[model samples]
Target chain A: MNEQEHIDKLMLELRRGTITIGVLSQLSSPQYGYSLVTLLDEKGIHVEPGTLYPLLRRLEKQGLLDSSWDTNEARPRKYYVLSETGKSVYEQLCVEWQSIVSSLNDLILNKGDDVNGDG
Target chain B: MEMVNRYVYAVTQRLPQSQREDIAIELRGLIEDMLEERVGDGGNNTDKMVEEVLMELGSPRTMAHKYRGSKSYLIGPELYESFILVLKIVLISVGITLVGAFAIKTVINPVEILDHFIEFIVSTVTAIPQALGWVTLGFALGEYYGGFKAGDLKLDKNWMPSMLPPIPHPKKTIKRSEPIIAIVFYVILMGMFGFSSNYFGIFRFSDGEFVGVIPFLNEAKFPEYMPFLLLLLALFIVKECLKLISGKWTMKLVVCTTVVNLVALMVVYFMITSQSFWNPHFMEGLMNAGIVEQGTEGYEIMETIWKNVTGATVIIFIVALLWDIVDGMIKVRKK
Candidate 1:
């Protein structure tokens, strides 16, 4: 493929890996599907409403989030927030993410081809 | 508003029954939010804005795929390779069988050679796609219903480390050519006997030009066993297919092939040993051709074949079947 196509595919993979963590990090407070999409966009994550809605449902299914409908308005909005299990999971995930970022930064900055001997 | 409902309905219809209503409500609410954002202070949602918004969200099928997670295939990737493998075998088997069956019909009563040839081509062409459809349907059912047997094709929910299959010995692996050759062989036998023993005999030549022949089967009696022979062969072909799919001596495979082949062998034994199963006119035809006479060694050979045909057939069947059965049992039980 040309450079644009290769970059597009690689960027999709990169964004997919981080999108879950971005969504999880925001759900400490209750937010509905569309609100979550807008909230992430302001932070530059730019998740589609279609993607976020299904992901919210899946996270609820996995017991990583809890959901309830607030039908008080003219239209009902399903709200999602981090569950008890989700809180602990996200905290541990943050620790792993921090370690991975540093390791990757070190490799990128140093441009190391060998771990045994540095260039 | 109607367009929004149609889009919501399209997405939710693909989801499961229980999740449909909840997903529909949630999807409708998301659309309204997006439309409101698009219209802004004017607070009017137009058809153009709705169309643009839905188009941006993309196809309803893609929306459903996101909701359902990994269920977008009729035969998923896990089952695809096996499905194609079974399809090839089934198509080849159908082609071989149609060719054999048509050859018998054409031989028994010679119509115009072209008519039989046309019929063979037409039937084989029709049969292959029908076979393809059936094989696809079978694999699709297995895929959707958690396999023909639960976890038999892949992982089970109740899987344990101990449940993992043992690595088969290298020698125990079934060669692809083995089942392929056996399927052709079975197709031939089904063709040979189903129409009653004809076409197999010493051919007579007059002045080096081909003449009329003697057949080894009683034309009238063998057709009586036709249905049973066809059923036996169908079972044998299925067993061979299982072998082709498994590619090794899996317990499920070995047990199936051994039992099916043994039953087929029994039907074969009965058909071979039945009274007058051999053509009574075999010797008479030989004598009539003047190729053999009462005092000739050729006559003695023909008589031996005619009288002791059952014994010879029984020996051949037992030897062939015993090798297949014993080979399977031993391989499957290997540590």
Candidate 2:
């Protein structure tokens, strides 16, 4: 693969872990799939619908999110909110992510292999 | 514009039926809002502009995955890995249990038993395609009926063809029995194979032990069990009637009838055990009803015929039980 393709592949792996964090953070209040996508996009995360929908479903299945159907409208919509477990995990992930970033930053500045490192 | 509609559907389809419509509505609004921004005072083709908006959004599966946030195990596309994992585990476990049960039943013929085992495995593997067809049909029918009745597939007029393709509402939702039929077919299949072979006999409790009192037509100690045949026909009629009627009465009828049948069987077994009417002379008295045995060979042939008939009856009853179970599963899945 070309250097650009390699970079893109690595970027995807990094983005996947971050995307779950991003989704959980947004679900403080109940939001449907599209609304969440729009909110994420407006914030410059630019997540695709494919990646978001399945992740939300997985999270819900894992007991991290609570979902309910809204039948009051002509077209019923399912709204999702972060569960109690999800809030705690998201908070922990945030703390871990910050520490990792700081540690990586220090390594990049001190180490000679900074050019090849993306983190 | 058409492409955009497809894109919107892709993302929304993953959502629960209740949420899919609102997500579609919101997506259409987003696209329209974007189109308006791009075409401000410009008389360019609105169709081309909408198509561009969709291209920027990405493919339908991708969009759906985004809206879905994460793949929920429920109502998501079938996962081959997970499916294979489950199928392998279940099939292997069933195979092991069946082998163990068969080994305990017979001691003489190892080669014959192995031959039967190989045949069973081949038959079971070949049957999976059929199983999948029935399972998918049952699930789809349940979903369509369940969601449609709940008003989860509605569309708004503002969401035009450009934003969303108008899918025809499914007319005449499948009744609950449709998926049940698929389940019934599988149960009948399993029961047929189970009882005939020693491979985990359907009603058999342990080695050489039959759970129910089965009529042995081949044995000269007892005459033909005409009353048992009549009872089977009655059960068939009752099953058919349950299919026709759909209410509290149908379920009540099934439960009450099943209980009545069980009680009648128990009574018959008790009577037979109380009176030793299984003597050779008593059976000879039954021979007086019709044509007497022409020869010993004739008696042997008659015995084989009766044995086959009894086997067929047992299979039929098993099929009915399977049908009931599959029907129940369909109902539960929909709920």
Candidate 3:
């Protein structure tokens, strides 16, 4: 593939990997599927409705999120929040993410220095 | 509103009955929220806004597939690699066998070579779809019974990197192609033995017309032992299939292989010793063809030669079977 397509594909995978953590971060307070989509979009994460809705269902099925329906509204909406287990898992994941970012930054910086040294 | 309902219907129809109602209600809420955001409080352009939102959301089938979390594939990823390996082995062996059969046919009847070539091509083309259909069916059944749940194809709660099977030593690991090729070979051999015993005979040609045919085994008696032969063939096929799925030598496989070989050897020994196994007219056909003279030294020599050949065949078969059993046991021991 051309450069743009290759980079786009890689970015898609990168974004997909982080989407779980991003969703978990948002679910601290109960949020309906559409509200969560809009919240993430405002943060420039830009998740699709189809993707976000399914992910919410899957997270709930895994007991990482607890969902309840609010029938008191104009239309019933399912609102999801983090479960107790989900909170602990999210905390662990944040620590893992920080370490990964630090290591990756070091590796990239060293590679850049090596390139300049060779030149 | 109608368009919204239709879109919701499209997505919900693909989901399970229990999930459809809940997902539909949630989808409707999401759609209305999207429309409200797009069209500010005015309801005048709602239909157009609904269409636009649905378009941005992508096709309902794609959304349904996402929500259902599994695409309906006839042969799923779990068995797909093994299926392709088995298909390749079957197709390649079948092609080679068909070519070999064509060559034999041409050698036996040079003048009718064109007819044989056409028949071979037709047979090969038909055999492909037949083999593929059966392989696909077998794998589909395997996938169904193998406890593969929808949306659970990848590693989930019960999976861990540490749970990965230990890498087998090169000698202990079975090549993916080995069992596949063996299964194909046994299938074809069984078909030939069960259906076309007459085709194994000696053919004589004279004056551009087929002359005497000395049949190897009595065709009439074949059906009497067909049930037993079929049972053995089924057992052999099962053994090969198990090997292909396991992809490594285990104690179970070793025991199975030993049992199948032993039973096959016993069957072969019994058949060879039975009077009905050989055609009664074979000697007479040889005499009629003038290959041997009646009540002469030539006839006695021919009889003695036939006896020795059958004896040698039995010995060779027994030895080969023993070798296979021993080899399997050794491999298992190494593992």
The most accurate candidate by TM-score is 3
The CA lDDT at B37 in model 2 is 57
Question: Between which residue pairs do clashes occur in model 3?
Answer: none
DockQ of each model vs. true complex: 0.75, 0.17, 0.70
What tens digits encode model 2's per-residue C-alpha lDDT throughout B213-329? 222222332234334434543454444335333322233444644554455455445434433323323224334433246466766675565435444554555565656545444
What TM-score does chain A reach in every model?
0.93, 0.89, 0.91
Fraction of native A-B contacts kept, per candidate: 0.81, 0.38, 0.81
lDDT of 1 by residue, A27-107 (tens): 999999999998999999899888888888988999999999999999999999999999999999999999999999988
lDDT of 3 by residue, B1-335 (tens): 99999999999998889999999888989888898887776565566787899998889999998897755677777667767877887777677777877887787778899999899889888987887888788888877776664445655667889989899778877887777777778777765766455677888777767764688777789778777777887787788888877778888888888888888989878977788887877888888887789899999998987777668888998898788778777887894
* lDDT for position B236 in model 1: 80
lDDT of 3 at B280: 74
> What is the Å distance of residue A45 in model 2 from its true position?
5.1
TM-score of each: 0.77, 0.38, 0.78
Residues forming the 10-long window of minimal summed lDDT in candidate 3 chain A: A110-119
Candidate 3 at B106: error in angstroms?
4.2
Scored by lDDT, model 3 comes in at 0.83
